[model samples]
Target: MGESSWAIDLEKQITTAEVDEEEIKRWVIDLEKNMEEEEMKTSRSIFKVPTQTTLLHKNAYEPNIVSFGPYHYGKSHLQLMETHKKKAVDYFLKNYGKPLNNYVKALEEVDQELRDSYENLDDEWKHREKFLKLMMFDGCFMLKILYEYKETLAKPGSENHDHFNFDPQLCLYIRRDMLMIENQLPLLGLVTLAAVQTGKSTVLFVLSFCYFLKLESNSKNSPYSNYINSTVFAEHTGVLNLPILIMDEITEISFLNLMAFERKAKGMGSAVSSFLAFMGSLINSEEDARFLRSKGIIQSTLGNDKAIVDCIKLLGKDMYFNPHSEMCLTQYRLNQYYLNSIKSWNKRLRDWSSNFMQTYVKNPWTLISLMVAGFVLSLTVTQTYYSIHKPK
Candidate 1:
């Protein structure tokens, strides 16, 4: 009886070992499948702020007035915009003559691709149905804003037609909120929805968006307005050259988010990074801010040159920039420009000239003495010349 019991126990041990091996094999296969799926979705664009960057200025990455994407969708502070978003969506669909279901279906098609663009999405938001609804609302809200801005620009008095057109300051905040890194919907999503509504080419729609950015950056009376308007409307075939480096609370947030996106997307040589680097190089001091103001490069409503300088300096802190990127090249060019500036000259002749002016030309008493000495010397020279050659 004891021998029979030992054999049964030995057989049970072997069976358990075989079952463990089978479970291990199943786990490996599942892991490989998950990895393959991740690889297929690796081309992400939008991202959560890295902890390192967020620690520098958390508020800059957050939307103050409105939230567009799922990242900030459920915040208590941002919930007020939900009604506004619904109204905008309704307005957009009504104008486009499409039912809300049509837009919902359109977004559903690209739901997975849209999900892939954002990182660290919550488990609740990971549901396909919930994410699709988010894309429809947020995407349409953005398109509505852009479409309204375009209409307002094309027809000066058309802003009154929009229900959400508030005070200028509120509008300014909304504009700034839209550009916040975390507050963005995918450009492809916006373009796709716009195409569904307007039947306009993507290129033209993007250009119109660029035009809105330009107009937002510049004041109505800005001297550069004409040039910017012409460049955007002219026969240019490249990306629009929007001036995004202005030193202000809004622009600083906008650029920081854009720079963050460029960094995450591995677009190290992008125009956004280059512009930021260029602006950072140009704004190291109050004098630098003043110089940019004189050149019409800084169009900030924020008061005081020091404020602009400080804002720019703050924006550059904790930023990740590649040394060999286009932004670095822009920094190199700026350094070269500074080295060639007249203020940077320190040659012997320049030193002597500066010293001479400071000592003999700057003080009233020394200037008067120099003038007297010059007159006396001129008289002496005239007298000596007359004595030598006067009646010869």
Candidate 2:
């Protein structure tokens, strides 16, 4: 049993005291004591982020997740739309970006469908045309639109998604930090667009952000904030945590104002109201997540072993989480948020359906059809999530 009598063993038992995370500490403790004693060893601390994040020049140009609310203060919407446009513009101007393709055009071609399905119906079926050209469908006109708007909008062709679609799309995922910035946007102004249910957009946003993190972790630099920055993918988290805060004070302030003012406006649009409600979810999510994270006071792998999960869930929605050595920081927590958001969203969706059902209770079958569609959207989201996380 002497240390010298040991066979060729490169193992060290993982002591509960050495593991910084509460979850990991519990996990190790749950293992057979003998195996753990023989397997664990003194390990280096894996907390802290890098001093400077390496960023891809292209990523700095990548789309931004937005908290675009009502259209009047569309400075937010403009930014979001520009993000998509950046992709289109990149195809011709940037370097090696892709074309918008027919998917966008299909929407344009289905004018009647747009009229049939859209609440507002007619004014802007073609208004988005110029946007389509500069974003989705490239044409000779793109250069002209790019030319005229360059001086006014951000460096012209370099406009980001934030400038284009203040409203988040399935593709636009706002980070916690983006809305946290002072005067940029309020926490509530952000759309839980990345969530799966009520705000499936939130789920899409986070998934997309993760993809960016993965890509930026490549040999290139990534402009994404450190919390989820891919640039520091390797290298031990070091002193600099991989997370960065994303805050937009203006967005938040404007959103509060927009809600107060729009409610009394004479010609209020349902789209505008619906959009505001969506933006409000971000705040609700932060509140709820924070409450959940604080449930049992667990430690994290972040600096000084702080309660990072709690922070991001509540006030930290504006913050991105950094990485820890040999582990994925906040993955479980983030997934939990996604699941919770999805659950809430589904319930809200049902509420909306119930309202629609009452309107068509006379036919009964119409009520049945709407219910079917809601069911389908829900299933689509489930399938999407499973496919993304399937035993990889």
Candidate 3:
């Protein structure tokens, strides 16, 4: 009777173990299904700086003077810019003749989409009203900067009354900060504001903004100047007709963040990504930096040539790139240039033996003189050999 009772107890324990295993399997399956559903939804475009990039150059990724998005929004050092941003917003509304409420309402409508653009925003920023205000203020400020820049360009040397232009260095730093990867507002915000204010498209606004970033024509000092001069600008507009060839002065942080955002939001084949990869390929050394400088492809007030090279290297550190993406004809041309340079060097090496001889024997008189000298040396050597063996 004791043996029978023990067997029954063991069987009940085994049954419970089986039930637990089945429950665990069901839980795992549900977890995977939920993960798949989440992936199907749109992912965030703005990201915290990746560990690899940040570890190399933390200062490059951090905002120094002004912060644009929620990532660095409330920093004590950046608070000074808040007042300027508010003023810019006021100016934007006044110029567009739209009430602040209208802009706020527009932002509210796309609030969810805007939130989706940024990864891991703070809980306080999660509130709809707060998020809308953030977007309204930030977006308007960016639009205002672009507007003022356009005006300045349109009417140069005409009593620069813009507050940002009061101190050129401060303005430059702010512009640089705006380009930082962590210091970005959604392009959607800018687009919405532009559409509401003017009947123009986002492309025009982007082009104008980039222009304000000072992407001038390729300087004669740029290594790419010859290539640019040889080809028609209209033929190779890259992936989006962006003026990527003249990105010499853009800050490292700005370029990296822009490319990161483009990659996340627009996918792998954006013109911005392609241009970055192309620049990365070109900038491997100081010589490369010098070449770029010669072509006016790079212009920096960051001291010297080494600084520029270091900056480019840091910008490209651990960058995400797909080699097979569509970069228009730019990638193909760059590859061909690299291959041709190698082939040319090989040809020079192959002709090196002939070149050496030609160096000393270029003219007919020089060739005859060398031949005579060689014949005399050979005759003297033969005579010496005979003397040494003359039955000594």
lDDT, each prediction: 0.70, 0.34, 0.69
lDDT of 2 by residue, 131-206 (tens): 2332232222222232234343445354352333333333224332122211121111122110211223222234
Per-residue CA lDDT of candidate 1, range 1-392, in tens? Answer: 36698898999898886557888999999999999767744667677888888888878788888888788888888787788878878887777797777777778787777877777778998788887878877777776676677678788976565778578787788887877667777777886777778766354444544543443444444443242232231112322233433455566766677777776765334555544555666578989888777767667778999888777777678455568655565456545555655464567678899999999988989999999999999999999999999894
Candidate 1 TM-score, true structure as reference: 0.68
What TM-score would each prediction reach against the true structure?
Answer: 0.68, 0.21, 0.64
Clashes of each: 0, 79, 10
Worst 10 residues of 2 by lDDT: 42-51
In Å, residue 347's CA in model 1 sits off its true spot by: 8.1
After superposing candidate 3, which stretches have Cα over 4 Å from the reference?
1-43, 93-95, 160-165, 198-204, 212-250, 262-266, 269-303, 319-392
Best prediction by lDDT? 1
Candidate 3, residues 1-392, lDDT tens digits: the string is: 36698888999898876557888999999999999657644656677866765676667778888888889988999888788889888777777787877777777787878887887778998788877888888887787777777777789976564755547688777788877768888888888887777756554444444454444443423332233223322323322122334434556655666665665554534445555666676688888878777765566677777887777676666455556544436557656666876998899987996886787667788888888999999999999999989974
Residue 329, candidate 3: Cα error in Å is: 11
Query: In what order do the candidates fall by lDDT, top score first?
Result: 1, 3, 2
